[model samples]
Target: FVSMACSSSSFPLMVSISGVRGIACRSITPELIVKYVAAFAYLQITRHQKDLPITEKPEIVLLRDSRVSGEWIERISAGVLQSMGANVLSCGIQPTPTAQLLALQRSNAVGALVITSSHNPKEWNGLKFIDSDGLFLSPESCDVLFQMVNNSAYQYPSFEQRGSFVDFADAAQIHIDTCTSLSYIDLEATKKRNFKVVLDSVNGAGGPIMKSLLETLGCKVIGLNLEPTGVFAHTPEPVPENLGQLCSAVVEHSADFGIAVDPDVDRCVLIDETGKPLGEEYTLALAVKFYLSATEKRGPICKNLSSSRVCDDIAKEYNCISYNTPVGEIHVAKKMVELNAIIGGEGNGGVMLPDVHIGRDALVAATLIVQLLSGFEGTISEYKKSLPQYQIVKLKAPIGNMVPELILADMKKKWEGKEGVTLTEGDGLRIDTSDYWVHMRKSNTEPIIRVIGEHQSEEEARKVCEQFMSEIQNWKAETSE
Candidate 1:
């Protein structure tokens, strides 16, 4: 089965198993989808190079978000996966992190298929594969998946041996329970405060559980986009400009604070009682603070290359360490496994703890936020007032698929000998200086090159990113001409 649609622009820029995302149709076709899933089934079933486990039939967890097409595509994937002798547990229309956590808790499931394109538009959808360990499939697994897809070595189970599907709505509740079980929470204190809360789910899968978690924490909840209808009122990315509804509702209802989760709810950003956006980076930063301070059992923290250096400050207080990995949850998760990290996440507002599985969980993050607010007994604004401050300017522009590598090369050459420039090759090119850092990365989900700069002031951050962006753009144009 030749797939003519698999090209640089059309094919998904698949990362490790958990992050294969891109625009729909162009990136993921029906045939390609089935073959890849079947290939995954092949790899999981064959993972035991030793004697196969007693569970002759491998089990898989199948889940999706609120995207209307999620059901159709998931049904197709289940058919192919089931055909390959993989029993499927359906946690229908769930958040991405929920699927991963459920896969971890279910003794029978060996992997999970999470259908989401995250913050991408409605026309887009994706498949994120998670292993039995609840971590996204490793880099090696993806290589094997693509090869297996091309090899046609997939073994389809016989009629009687074929696997079956079961409806497991309880999976979400199980996930919620596991998250609450983490030692970080003081539910007595949180419930005693009786905080007021407002939330914008962006009409995504987060609606089902984000509000539920808040209510369970004793928050007086006012929720927008709670219907789970996928009729997005904003871009669904939780950026400040797009967060007007959440902020306004916070003030209108006079809520203690407001929260925003992207479509899948794996990431969360915040707004204060004043209706002022705390932005995404602070979500991770606060989580780190609460996580590190919660117990004396401090360990190295893991963070992404594109994230703020606030973790550096937080780590200093504990005399613990921080390891910066590539800008993806899997990379951070791998490092966490290596370092036994206490907490870690991306600046996109995702937080992962070893207590739970390795994934960005909005519910866990929200729980941390509430705990912080409870511990301090102040508004979100007051709690954030004491943290170290830096202004990060985020920018991006279109670049051809081939240009990113060239731009990275030029950046290294151009900034290498500069007195202030120090470089780290984590994801792409992270050029550091005495007081700031700039990272230019090729986005896994989009065609644009993302340029991020953090400095003491917004003006300085802008200057850094603009200079780098201009130099790269001009260099690429000249090379093409």
Candidate 2:
């Protein structure tokens, strides 16, 4: 919700509902890490002790991604938790979802902290706090934690009362086992197909577990950037432009398809057999279709305002209603639980299955993709072609001195009471027309305004985005004048 734009010379730290992120050694120093961790631990300890016996110390699951500073961050984070009289269950170099699942499974665990920048460049590092229910902190909880940080409201326990630390090495395998054990997976049938997959982990935390999961499901893996070095092979967003290498490799190896995951392995993208990237929006659409077709249990579907409308189309086909919340995985996940949604996720290749735990998980997404492909007679691209098609264009504009709220307020006024245009406000401004929709919101992870437009065709989507981008710029100009 913070609108201050991020720049190297200006404020480099980004703390929002998503978590805290900044350039390593610059804005995210050891002191900053300790302060945040201590505050989080204190919050968890006080919040949970009331529900439990007095003798029990709150347990926290701590993990990290493949950033170069992850190790030291983990050490400092663990030390802070221990000093605050909270036991630390350290799972070194595991995906963010894995840590969330572990936290949910541990009955004594009150929360978790993941040291990851999650698809950011290697120079960035941060923390993602997960509550006992295995979801990110809600907005209200985040406000309380930030207040605690600002007030310096943390206390350390005596030396004898400090908590213990233990290493948990089986977290990745546990996540794989959970994914394969799902009844809908049909691992044996998928294994019979003997899929040839080209996996690109970009040398992040997902490399080992993703490869292991594919092979366990009887895939012939052609690994790229499999090592968990902090250095990435390319930009780590897993977008189309950043995945040229994976596309070429899939064609060169003549593989069935290629799979790409972000650094934390929460988002999953695919390259078809023809060496073409399926836009990230399709990851959720395909997963929803597959789940609906494969199961008899029907429920509502939830997605973010910025996600493609194809999900609504699919939901209607199955006689299920679809709901849209503000942008953020936690928002979607909470809505899913409220609606008992069978499946929900974001548009950025994040798929959340409540059965597998309420978090965006690449392992679950990849497993669904493999199982869905195994039953089909054609290639990946063909399967994508058969689904409801829509073009989604995502663009960002810098929010210079102008306030995002004022701009969004103006947009609401401009589009309000139009023929078929409906405006949705709260997180940002979303204008839904008869043919298309455009959502403008402040980025939770970065310092800019994210403009997402979707329509039946690429041209129309781009046009809508450009029109709105021009309008926003003009507003800034008028304000300056």
Best by lDDT: 2
Instruction: Pick out the ten consecutive residues of candidate 2 with the lowest summed lDDT.
Output: 1-10
Clashes of each: 0, 0
RMSD of 1: 2.8
In candidate 1, list every pair of residues with a backbone clash. Answer: none
lDDT of 1 by residue, 52-161 (tens): 46745678889888876677788899898778887888888778888888777766677888888888777778888788878888766776776777788777768886
Model 2 ranges off by over 4 Å: 1-11, 53-55
Candidate 2 per-residue C-alpha lDDT over 136-183 given as tens digits, one digit per residue, 9 for 90 to 100: 888788888888898998788789879999998889999999999988
Task: Supply candidate 1's per-residue lDDT for 28.
Answer: 64
117 in model 1: Cα distance from truth in Å? 0.6
Score each candidate by Cα lDDT: 0.81, 0.91
Summing lDDT over every window of 10 consecutive residues in candidate 1, give the lowest-scoring window.
Answer: 1-10
RMSD to native for every prediction? 2.8, 1.5
Assess candidate 1 and give its TM-score to the true structure. 0.94
